[model samples]
Target: MHREISELIEIGRLLHSRGWLPASGGNLSVRLEDERVLITASGSHKGHLTREDFVVVNLKGEVLEGSKKPSAETELHLLVYRVFPEVKSVLHVHSINSTLISRMAQEDIRLEGYELLKAFEGIKTHETSISVPVLENSQDMEELSKRIEKKLREEKVYGFLLRSHGLYTWGKSIREAYIRLEAFEFLFECELRLMPLA
Candidate 1:
């Protein structure tokens, strides 16, 4: 349990150093073996997260332990666990490339013919294509969650983005989740670099 908390803290520190989690702009969560989730608390800055900065919550988003409130984006994290039982960790980030690409893209950001596209699961080659559904940002997480569920059910998605917001990606572990996030960011950066700034 302590090791798991330390893993989250290390990832948070790494993300913060890369400027992907500026302030409290993002959230992190991992599912415990007993079906509870360890999540960053509300208003807790990922850059300086401690064990106390995290709280344990059930799949229903109710806090079962810890003194702090769960991340405001708690529902989103819970949704991933419910949807993908195999997934153990969730990582959301507010990086410049993901944010700008979300706005630049249409309804979904599609990537193809890139070697990094193989970074996502089940993809054996670059011949495949991936469309990351990008929905408009909403303060109402319930509504946004509903939209994501509908989209996820209709297709195979490694992750999604909130327009003008950020990216949400998950995996079987903290390492896998970070790998996917890093791949997505690199792909987005490549796309951005192809377009000249206004």
Candidate 2:
């Protein structure tokens, strides 16, 4: 558990250095087993995360250990795990591209014909299209989570965006989650640049 926490913190620092997460803007978590998860606590700078900064939470979103409070966005992570049993890690970031793209898209952001689209698992060709869902931003974690669950019932998604908020991507491991985050950011930037000049 310590090792996993440490590795995640390292990735957090990397994301911070790259401007993916600025200040205290993002949260991350990894499912440790069927019942336990390691998550960054609320109010901590992701880049400067320490072992003590992570709290263990159960699948039900209850804190199991650690003195710090789990992230306010913890319920979203719990919802992902509940829906995708194969998912072991989730990464949320507040990069400019994700925030801008999410705010710009009315309903969904579609990535099609980009070679980088293959970065997401299960995609082997550039001709594929992925519709990343964007939901209205909300401060209520429970309500936001319920909305995400409802979306899950009707659609298959690799990730989703919170309007004017950030990007949320999950995977089978911390590494895969990071990769997907990178891919999403790249796609967002490409779409932004492709916008017609005003």
Scored by CA lDDT, what does every candidate get?
A: 0.93, 0.90
Residue 159 C-alpha lDDT in model 1: 93
Q: How big is the positional error of residue 34 in model 2, measured in Å on the Cα after superposition?
A: 3.7
Summarize candidate 2's per-residue lDDT along 1-198 as a digit string, tens digits.
978988998998999999989999899999996578899999999899899999999988888999999999999988999899999999999999999998788778888999988888889999889989899989988888888888876777899999999999999999999999998888899899998765
lDDT of 1 by residue, 103-131 (tens): 88866878889988889999999998998
Model 2: residues with Cα > 4 Å off, grouped in runs? none
- What TM-score quantifies how close candidate 1 is to the native fold? 0.97
> Residue 116: error of model 1 in Å?
1.2
For every model shown, what is its TM-score relative to the native structure?
Answer: 0.97, 0.97
Q: Which pairs clash in the backbone of model 2?
A: none
Model 2: weakest 10-residue lDDT segment is: 148-157
